[model samples]
Target: METEGVFQSLPALPLFLLMFSIIYLIAYFIVFRNWSPSIRPEASSCLISLSHGTPAVFLATRAILAGQNRGFAASNTVFQNLVLDYSIAYFLMDLLHYLMFFPSDLIFIGHHSATLFVFLTCRYVVSHGAFAILFLLILAELTSACQNAWTLANARKGDVEFAAKLYDFLSPPFYALYSIVRGFAGPYFVYEMLVFFMTGVADHVIPRWVWISWIGVVLMAISVSILWVSNLWLELYRERTKKLEKKMR
Candidate 1:
């Protein structure tokens, strides 16, 4: 089938959203219902994050490897479809979840909005940088499984020993992965886009709105990374100091 024809017939974006919405509903009503009210939504959200994130990591990795010789423009369109599908679903669910359950979480709302805007732009408007977007998706999703697992552990704070041990074991790797991906690579991706826009290296010049949305997405990622990492370090410091003070007694 012609690629464009397939895209038209498949309607990948809406199907993706519908599939994940069903999954999220199942998770919320069936899987996570036994959990405490406050924890259920977050736990369900974590599961949804992993569900999309795992495949994204796989598809993005494959695309990047396969595209090395051919370049992103020649990369498999399937990979692009998968990445955009997973992202659109995840972001939509996240936005809806936040709106319904945690409207005050403005940071996440901003993050989701900016990300969705850019993804939709790439899907419907400019389509030159699919490979870069997929690569960045991989970098972003690699930490989701770990981060959500760690978060779920912390939420069940009654398991103090388990939480502490898991935190200690997971903290280093999570921080490192998050830093490498969002902290460093995210900014690099933004820089490359800016250069492309400014230097006219791309086949077609990206629109100003696309550039603005893309920058907003990257900045949100970097800002969240800084805030989260700083808070993590601060918590670790407090925990260490408490232990130190107790030891002095």
Candidate 2:
């Protein structure tokens, strides 16, 4: 009863963060122990994300649909706030993963930090503008399961034959899905969000710098994703070409 009361009284976001941390620990120490020592943390990270990504897409979309009348900069609905809290918790866990296991990974660390800033501000500071943010979340995480599966497969490819085969099988489709989401649809939505905010609609509810900064971070994330996927495509092409040359010989 005492513990239940304390937990019930705890604030939502921090409590949610605690739950994510517990999940990460269990994934790392128990579920993924057979994975490569170096890969264990990341695999666990991916699992943690798998828990959030697709669910977030649905939750955010539901929130958007429920609150359509409020417009883009309107105050967050209950579901929208829950989605934001869920995402903030995931990013916090992921950031800690990078910080603990791979401190040298500055780009990811910085990316997570920027993302948390965006979510934190939305969830706490301004409290409005979740419409744009959650809609963007839906776009960004639509491919999360595929990407995470591909990532885990790629990680295990060197030692595990099935993993290598799975990686090969999944890469092209995963890349296609990711390219469409991050490259095209996401950018289009960002443009819409920017127009709304910049054209003076979001201006009244969201601060000038706040909305600009949010969109700016999202644009940067999209640019990096595009570049990353472009490289992956080139690498896949090179691999296929090498195989074709060998077959001809």
Candidate 3:
């Protein structure tokens, strides 16, 4: 009886794969085929342009200061250094998302939304993930620049005050909310992917190329995490600088 039960269970894998494949094919043909093109590439380009341009403008202003012997060289260095740090952070995070999240989402979700909730949730996950990571990188850079500006102001006038205290006060709560939502999304995605795999549909409908893409995505995610850690180190460095400055005065 035990052997028979085991044998019977073995066939479920193929069945699961079959069901998943059929559903995926139908969705791909009927739904995805008709949907509007994604604007993600445009958004990504805009973000890169904004990030690169911000530092360029700062550097240009400092260059003018340096010409006048007003301590602008140091300012230029500060801005350039922060830009390099942020660029690296952005690259790594993007690489990771492409490698891990993209593949996992495609394999599991694949544009199959049976209800409005699922569809909205899927869109939110993909969009919010991109926006949040970009926002985090930008915020880190802005924070670093603000700290630097504060230090410079104090050096010149003997007192320093942050201009955006209200904004800073609100950031923590928003960041917390973003983290909570993003944290749960990953596990839920994996669960759904597992369900599709068990149904044997993943193997049947999802081409080999798609599977290969997923593997690449996983590798990218790992790379992104590594970069994120480096970015955190910069944050720590900023905090340490603040503490040291307080001790000095």
Candidate 4:
């Protein structure tokens, strides 16, 4: 009864989007008031991911499990739709941040744009595939907390000893987790999604091009993640080697 009431009174998607945007502003203007001007906006952006990632995983899981009909193109339940709205809101806010502060970062901005297109289509256009997309969201965000921590640590490591140490401590673990997810798990799931979508089982539920685009966007994102993490691994190896050389000298 309580849960039902909660769903009944859940705010509309636009209002939810507004709330997420407010959270981003609050992070930059209030919580990180003392942070460096350049770093603060990015930090606040990371905060929004932290605010979204883990919780979205759990919520997506709950929605997936509670849903009655299940398929790549099955109709979405109320809970599932709500979870999609939450993710859509997060991506939109984060996209705005990148556009405003880091417009030169085409990789992130493009990635966010592609992701939003996929999510928007799933939520509004086709009204299906919440299961697949939300599961992908879970995989994508599984390492977000560690990644964000490492990012924050990396951002300040130049000037702060503790931040440097934290960055060092976090690098290997975060890289391994991200690699496993992006390299192995992510590809596997996407492969499943592609095969499922290709079968035309969802022809009546989702248009062909839409699911194709979703798969394309997902594949591109995974490729980018692999490339991004590969660079981090190389950088980590060099950093550690330099540390060892300095200590030995």
Candidate 5:
């Protein structure tokens, strides 16, 4: 596949360092440095630190899983390949979110007219940039889990269907809460929208046909949202019916 060829042609080390620097900068400036004194009076709380560390923890766990799987060898070549792929993908999105989209806040906030533009812009930039990185890290973990399920199915006669279902069940609530907070409660929905667009760009890893299959899955998710709404209404109706029956009885 040209996947290897494309990755090999890039400057892997520099890109990796750049990606790491972006991650660090976002963590320090946004989460740690700007953390309100009202939230914490002393050293950062464990919860706060863990919240900041979640993305790294998630990625490190995935790397460990990938190493343990014989299919993904822990040798130098495998390490290099994974580093190159992730570094390129991560850096491209990081640059897009931090460098490109962040500066546009000036235009949206009226640059000079809005007195809060400076603070809002900083908050918006950091939140959105962190979100993009976090989302990509989650996707990487999910992809690894999917690969692991396939490996188990082929090599060990495991139930791939069960693994897939379990992963699916867990993903939605996480994504729902993330989407809500990132969309509604955060600085601006525009940032979340941008993150969503960047995610679509990152899905370029697969061939066109395979990518279309992913789009179909996304469409199915939209349908599922409709069904979820219907189900909620049905539950409410059933509860009301039970109450009427009890009153009559």
Candidate 6:
């Protein structure tokens, strides 16, 4: 109880920074230090996937356990300190990692920056609708985790026949999951958030500016996801074209 109270009292950004540092250190030790140097990047991503994905799925489960009457809302204590804390921390780390390793990736940097801004606002300024947004954020990560796993495992040296076979097996499901979550469900969640604000349907009092800020952030998230999904589809299309040519030959 005391610990929970302390967590509740702590400011959101500081808490996020603290949690991110911890997760970064752990990921460094697990991925960079211990993994194959060739696959370090993928391993680092894998660590992040497990760290964030596990908890998001767990929180979703807890909500399931709590039963269906619980409509999507801003999290309660356990959800906030446990789930949201870790989430913001992961985003912070992800943002920094991209800045350091792939500085040219401006799109990702912008996505992370915009997301961090909304999270910080929820922590400090907004009083309502955060849980719904956070839930969506984490839910998206669930598919990301699986997608990363598939990518990392596929990035192996192998015979051409075996590699092509593996790629064919894995690519469809991965794209399907990505499409369903980031493409389809993502827009739905954004719509829900919009409705929450437009209809004055939040769980707490949301100031006008806060509402505007939150809606903008959600829109940004949706925009990025659309771009990402488009890229995935393009890759899938090219892969199919290559296979058709090989068959014709």
lDDT of 5 by residue, 1-249 (tens): 476566567765566556555654555456446554432211122222233234444654454455433221112233334433343344343333334335554432231222122212212322112232223334333333333333222332233467445544434444454444433333243344344444555333322343343334333433443455456446546866897999999
Instruction: Please give the ranking of all candidate structures by lDDT, highest first, separated by commas.
Output: 4, 2, 1, 6, 5, 3
Candidate 3 C-alpha lDDT tens digits along 1-249:
574355444543344334433443444355335432342322332333344435634543443343323220111222222333334333333333344435465422321211112212212322111122222233333333333333233232322235244334334443343333333443344344445444544344344444333334433443443454456446656866898999999
Per-residue lDDT tens digits for candidate 2, residues 32-128, read 9887798999999999999889989898888888875657789876667777888999999999999999999998998999999999899889989
The lDDT of each candidate is 0.75, 0.88, 0.36, 0.89, 0.38, 0.66
Cα misplacement distance, residue 204 of candidate 1 (Å)? 2.7
Worst lDDT run of 10 residues, candidate 4, spans 3-12
- Residue 5's lDDT within candidate 1 is 71
Query: Which of candidates 3 and 4 is the stronger one according to TM-score?
Result: 4
Model 4 per-residue lDDT tens digits across residues 12-58: 57776898788888998999889899899989998999999999989
- Backbone clashes (count) for model 3: 11
Model number with the top lDDT: 4
lDDT per residue as tens, model 6, 177-211: 77777777878877876776676665355666776
* Candidate 6 wrong stretches, greater than 4 Å: 1-3, 6-39, 60-78, 154-167, 201-204
Report lDDT (Cα) of residue 4, candidate 2: 38
lDDT of 5 at 81: 41
RMSD to native for every prediction? 2.8, 3.5, 24.5, 1.7, 21.9, 4.0
Ranking by TM-score: 4, 2, 1, 6, 3, 5
Residue 131 of model 1: what lDDT? 69
Task: Give the per-residue Cα lDDT of candidate 1 at 135.
Answer: 70
Q: For all candidates, what are the clash counts?
A: 0, 0, 11, 0, 0, 1
Query: Is 5 or 6 the stronger prediction by TM-score?
Result: 6
All candidates: TM-score: 0.87, 0.93, 0.28, 0.94, 0.23, 0.76
> CA lDDT of 47 in candidate 3?
38
Worst 10 residues of 2 by lDDT: 1-10
